[model samples]
Target: MDIITSHPRIVKMKKNDITLYISTFPLETEDDFLEKLKETFDVEEACDGKNMAECFAIIYGGIVISKNSIFKRIELEGYFKESDKGIEFEINRFLENPYNCYTFDNGTICFIKNKEKDSRFVDNVGLRFIIK
Candidate 1:
């Protein structure tokens, strides 16, 4: 799925017709977001991954308004909502439970959620990556 289109915004999920880019904090990709984030990783390595980071960034209003976005920091691995767009159904961050997404300010998206909190990070993205 070489999504060379303007934005990967599908507007509806094939499975449930779930509306896209209607998140609380704006998940829509902006026009220049690709260029802004292009600096963070190797072009091929960065854009090419299961995390679908680039796809999500592109479709979900690609503009990274803040340098503090989770994408700028870690290698988040997960399955994409739309295999073509690269949005690996991670989390809205606002609607999802803190246990499913990364809750630490130090900058880290947790892949594993442990109940034992040693005054460290918190898992808000849940136990699994939502593979479907």
Candidate 2:
């Protein structure tokens, strides 16, 4: 696994959805990360692996939210050939707009939220992204 300490916001929500705060630095080399993500998510390769090259930042977060009870489980058999990373699936219920979707090179889907310093949603969500 890559050194993900900087982006502590990446976490398991429930069991299917992943929500990521994209303002942080991007994850490891976009290519490698996407390859791992595609294998992790089990999404069929839509085109040649070349399509993955256009991804932006690497996102890490939970996919499952409270509204849905079903969990999106990701099989890690071929993705990580070594150590077994504890993977958790979660459902995402906070999506109010499709514009919030952020996709990495490998097809990892992350929901992003952009807010001001004094936004009430931030205060209520109690979300902290700092590594400390």
Best by lDDT: 1
Q: How well does candidate 1 match the true structure in TM-score terms?
A: 0.17
- The 10-residue segment of model 2 with minimum total lDDT is 74-83
lDDT digits (tens) for residues 1-132 of candidate 2: 332222112222222233322222122333443454445543334223521211111132222222233223221111111112222222232233322323322333333254433221211111122322
- Distance (Å) between predicted and true CA of 123, model 1? 36
- CA-lDDT, candidates in order: 0.28, 0.26
State how far residue 74 of model 2 sits from its true place (Å): 21
RMSD (Cα, Å) for all candidates, in order, is: 15.8, 15.8
Residue 38, candidate 2: C-alpha displacement in angstroms: 11
lDDT, residue 54, candidate 1: 34
Task: Report the lDDT of model 1 for residue 130.
Answer: 16
Displacement of the residue 49 alpha carbon in candidate 1, Å: 11
